[model samples]
Target chain A: MHVSAILTVIGRDRPGLTQALADVVAETGGNWGDSQLARLGGHYVGSVLVELPAGGLPALEQALRCLPDDLTVTLVEVTPEPHPPEGSRFSVSLVGQDRQGILREVTSVLAEMGVNIESLETGLEHEAWTGQKLFRADVQIFVPASLPLEVVADALEHISGEIMVDINLSEALR
Target chain B: MHVSAILTVIGRDRPGLTQALADVVAETGGNWGDSQLARLGGHYVGSVLVELPAGGLPALEQALRCLPDDLTVTLVEVTPEPHPPEGSRFSVSLVGQDRQGILREVTSVLAEMGVNIESLETGLEHEAWTGQKLFRADVQIFVPASLPLEVVADALEHISGEIMVDINLSEALR
Candidate 1:
């Protein structure tokens, strides 16, 4: 039986990092499925999905832990879940002057509203004219079918003004 | 001498599409540099950077144009620009009910303030409880050294109410 797993890795950026990881996966009879890898702040970070024979996971984990260059690897066995039924998917975006607790507050609201973040990317950019740093985030979230859009929007709207940030929520385009 | 070029391709999603493009690039002696490729809304779209011997651009373009599978290709020569000097980077995020002109209005403000957008991603999502469609956007912008943070933040803050969307701007984490 085939089993799926997620491998997360982080280390100082270097050449051949991907190849090194791939070599281990291959040796363990694992097939690379999908990955998101990037270098940020001189560090290489990535998460990859791998499929392998059910019995090979332990060996795969051991091999991954032994990779060179001080790379750290974490493995999680994943049971593929059934495809989710059709439901509402929304995109949430926020930007504000860099401050502490923005994510905490925003996520708290999401949690209270029962929104599940599917994917989120956050980064900072400078204002062209002012040179002021700004925090920005793009998020894809799944909303349950039972909630009212107004409630979620209203909840975010209520806090946005107080936080001095702009918030926009919309249905994800198909 | 080496020249850099960008290839933007779009076609119906299918296997072997990347291989076909790689084959053409290889035949033209182009070296793949980097790419962002994804399947979205049943279409395969990708932008790739390639390095080639200075004289091979025309042949590369010609070969790409003739690719099968109804693929569309556009090629542009890219002159690498020097990295911008260290300046503040900011993140901008926005969300509102899906509507026309949100981008136009928001971007207009940025342009008027002389902010430069480094990256922008936009999408729609449905509210989980309400099923209301929301429009969302995330943007990375470069702030010039001369502008004050308040000027940009205040500008967006002024419009958030009128636009019925939330907008936040913050300094990006280094």
Candidate 2:
């Protein structure tokens, strides 16, 4: 039987890195699946899903370990869940001047409301004219049906005012 | 003394593609700035910002043309704008069963309202239990200060009903 696994790889960026990983997976009879790989700050970081015969995992792991250039690989077994839990998906965004604790404060409120963050992307950018630093975040969250959007909005609005930043919460498309 | 340029590259997925591009830029006296690069469907695609002395641009272009494999590179000149126009930034999102004309219809409304889409990301996913295809989009937009948020929200709400989708519009955090 085939089993699913999550493989995370990280190393200094270099040429032929992806090919090396693919070569190992192919040799081990692992079928590559969904992955998000990127070069950040001169480091290659990625998470990949793979399907392989249950018996071949150890060999795959061993082969992956043999990759050159100090690449670190971690493998974890995963079971596919066919159904997503019932919840309303929403998108939350925050943008303001650079400051510490923005994520902490916002996520704290989310945690209090029993919200789960599914995906989040954050970055720092400069304002077009002033060239002032700006912190921006986009997050996808799952809100339990028991909680109302207004409750979440009110709580966030309260924080937004204190932080002097803009906070937007809306139902996610999908 | 320096000019900014946007470079976009797309090619078959392989190792060392980023390194290759970086080498060319470095040799051309370009300082890499911000970049977003990703692998999608066996293809590598990326956009990068570079700052370089004006005279180095021609050499950079020449070096990029010599990259191994058929990677396509396009460079466009960008001037740093000091100030954003007088407008409010907003987030607009829509989610519903996969259907045709959703983008066309929604964008048409924005156009009529004199709204500009700054960035947009859209995707399709399957429903958890039913496996139905769902289409979703998240957009960051600029609405002239003269136009109120309620106006944009109302226009989208009207289309949401006709398309049987959920739509939300709110001032973006900024």
TM-score of each: 0.51, 0.52
List candidate 2 stretches off by more than 4 Å: A1-174, B80-83
TM-score of chain A of 1: 0.95
Q: Model 1, range A1-174, lDDT digits (tens) per residue?
A: 888676656554443465567678877887655445554333445456566887889999889878983676766666445455445888888888865446556766776677665555566678898998777766666677788888889988988888888899988875
Q: Relative to the unseen true structure, what is the C-alpha lDDT of residue B137 in candidate 1, on a scale of 0 to 100? A: 73
Indicate the DockQ of the complex predicted as candidate 1. Answer: 0.02
List model 1 lDDT by residue over B92-152, tens digit each: 8888876545665776677777776554556567989899878777766767778888898
Top lDDT prediction, candidate number: 2
**What are the RMSDs of all candidates, in order?**
22.0, 16.7
Query: B108 in model 2: Cα distance from truth in Å?
Result: 1.4
Candidate 2 residue-wise lDDT, A1-174, digit = tens: 987666666555443455566668777877655555554434455556566887888998899889984676766666444355567888888898865456556767776777766555566789999999887777667787888888988999999998899999987976
The lDDT per prediction is: 0.68, 0.68
